[model samples]
Target: MKQFLRSGVVAATLAVAGVSGAGVALAETMNVTIVAGHPPVFRWVKHASQTFIPAVNKALEGSGTTIEWSEQYGGSLAKVGEELEAVEEGLAEIGLVSSLFDPAKLAPQNVTYFTPFVVSDSTLVSEWMDKLQSSNADMKAAWEANGLEYLGGAIGIDDYLLMTNFPVKSIADLEGRKIGAPGPAVNWLKGTGAVGVSGNLTTYYNEIKTGVYDGVIVFASAALPGKLHEVAPYITKVGFGAQYAGGFAANKDWFDGLDPAVQQALRDAAEADRIAYHADLDASVSKFLEIMTSQGATVTEVDEGFRAQWAAGMDNVAKVWAEKLDDAGVNGSAVLKDYMDTMRAAGAQPVRNWDQE
Candidate 1:
């Protein structure tokens, strides 16, 4: 997934055209392809791409620069774990990359997903991320070093919950259960003694049906689209908390090559997409819950004490992650602290600190 920018080829092609131009000849249309690991029905990635592509085209309407899109959703272009590298290597011009799935590449920022019960409000989460991106230099460098540029991001779904074949009434109920969790979510299995099987929202259905696992930890918004209610009817809101999910990124060289106006337009479009996508997700939760319940899913709210117990059970993986990154010469601890401070200022109450709490 590597893309090479050939300035010499462009210049040679322009010279061969017999148009002796003193200035660079810009293309009338820019063919931009956006890739998503999830299916088109996933709200965050789907709606963001849907909202951005049109707004970008509208911004370039009279500029004679048309924005064309090629969306490869449902892991068609890049699988769940391959998004970060796919974008870094320019497999697609732009892509929706998940930090949780690519911890090795995203590290400190990905630690946020591992820190349970840190932030609950999606709006605050999204707003705080915006502030972090603007003020945090290390955060910027983290992405820049990967040959990518972050436009902006959206908060995906709400807090995660456990949807299982058996009702989760207590922490002890989880013992010995083969639970399906994403890579970052495996930390939740600590102390509970639950057998954690790594899986994503995309694979939950088939895995659960085939008896690969007894239950799955996922957000209702995403689980609804996959019809998870039918198979796993017991829903326990264990408060895994809100995740930053993923965001749009482009090849740095390709992004820098764009005109300033076009660059601003693309950024503006992505910001708008972030707001709209989060709002849509916040609204969709209740609607999906109703739909899921009507279809015979038993939705239960876990006791607040139990939720706290679960949050406390997982070790502060953030510090472990930061130390790992520090060994690699990356300033992960500072980035994590700055993000936590910004989130707190934005009205978020973190349950623990990555450095010291």
Candidate 2:
């Protein structure tokens, strides 16, 4: 009886030890909140989270290192204007930021938006951005100074166009017209004689219907879902320049806290998400145009010469922006030149050089 009791005590101790060892070997799980100012319906934010979450989970599968998400869409967490600061302060681990909206924080890199007619293709633009990030340490340092790191980026809506209450066939038609444009887009209206009113996509539908503005500067992909077509049926393809590829940015401190393996997983997921998001966007552009036309929106193709004229008129905003950044003591001029040089090296031809007179 004594021998049997001693054996039972030894067995219990071994079981407890085994459980403790297993716990020690298991990796810790992390919860990351990814915030986007736009609604979930927008492809840039929606598809990124949808595709990225799964890829990350798969990468960490069976490793006991799980990433749970806190997805705040439709400006539920961070308002569109406050995204950069929100992520920097760790309110969100990741965010989808628009450089165009936060030029003060992003500076000369925002020149991409200021320089109209520089990039016509989204794919080439995206590739050029990747090259810029890799080659330009100064650009990365700019984001780092803001306590954020740009992992990768996805394209926003395609080239912007005018969706107005009235048809805009020529630049003369825009004289004194009250046009609603997102903040950075106001530069595109320079010299066009259009009265630029500040607005964002979230309020575009109601503002255009209720406000005194006659039309909005928006892209087809974004306009289709926002139902801007219903309010402004006259779709004018003004050949406005392509926008920068917006994407996943994270709090640098939070990112640095992760294990190296997890860091790589996040980056890989971001890259995959970017590719998938662009594919969906490319398809949606055609589909949205079709839907708008079917819904009685008058889609007019502006003359190619007129498009060139508009591009020429709005070309120098980049230089103006770069000088502003340089004046502020940021390395704005170098960053801008590097980005343009990268685009050129990749066989891209700018409609106009912002650095030139």
Candidate 3:
């Protein structure tokens, strides 16, 4: 069974017997198990440990309630994409639920990926996604439907780069090439003539090394740690834009049972985590690019014309994806339009207005 409040003898005494000074019973202490699929090596997971936990602890200091936190990360408790189920089923109270991996269930969470080349600023993407999750009914329903509450620690992936053994100057160069892409990002290769194979960070390096695929569509923050530059030395700055991979989420039943102060503390801590994660991630992108080049990787940014051509060459996968979701009763078109409109209102200059098309 799911462990909730572990009210020991001390907690019981405090709860039943009113304090001498305040004459009020103390709230029972909570036992919260936080889970994440990614290890501490990633900024998102690191911030969850270093920033979010501490913030929650600090926030609840004088609130008459305390919590015992259990952190299970790096697939120890739940693998990537399984976090939602873990929380929903009461295996964990909270987790870093990756919407990128759970595309079918959390289809609305991947709006940014479906419409790439919109914005490369991780902070911007994170901020806007936080707002959408909080204010948008469709976005919030996605989490609530799964028995989870959206906690707002949005994971913003930096601008995606094409890391390959061969240099790509034009779309024609990708003809017949087997390129690896993560989740919904494979659709970005449509109409470009490249064979987009489904792959992820964990397998990109070995896959490229052993000739499983020629290259991968990846981001710098992850590329540096994975040492992908060593295998795929030609890094093209494709600028697929920052992506909202996922965010912190908690089991709704567990959350609803918590004190209002405790619930607010979790939400506040999530905001803190989002800020710290994005700041660290933003700083790492340029540093990682320099480091990759210093280590003999050739990093080149595609020209504006090339970027435009690439965006133009790709089919309107966003529309197709949104329509498919709408057909399934998720209101995908509304999400797509809202995301694009929100980004534009926030000063983003997208290479292609996916919603317009």
The local distance difference test score of each candidate is: 0.77, 0.76, 0.88
* TM-score, cand. 2: 0.91
TM-score list, all predictions: 0.90, 0.91, 0.94
lDDT of 3 by residue, 1-357 (tens): 243543332334443365453565555567778998878887788898899999999999977777788999988999888888899888888899999999988989989889989999889999999999968789989988888889888999999999998988778989989999999999999888989998878788899999988899999999999899999999999888999999999888778877788899999999999998888988889999999999999988888998899899888989999999889999999999999999999999999999997
Tell me how far the alpha carbon of residue 224 in candidate 3 is from the true structure, in angstroms, after superposition.
0.6
Global CA lDDT of candidate 2, please?
Answer: 0.76
Candidate 2 clash pair list: none
Runs of candidate 2 exceeding 4 Å displacement: 1-24
Candidate achieving the largest TM-score: 3
Candidate 1, 178-203: lDDT as tens digits: 99988878777887879999889888
**Higher TM-score: candidate 1 or 2?**
2
Model 2, 1-357: lDDT tens digits are 001100011112333644554434445557777888888878887776688878888898877677667788788998876777788877788888776677677765565777676666676676567556556776677678788878886554587879999888789899998899887788788889999998888988988798678899999888998999999999988767677735678888778766788778888888888788778777778789889999999999888788779877764777777777778887777877887776777776776776666
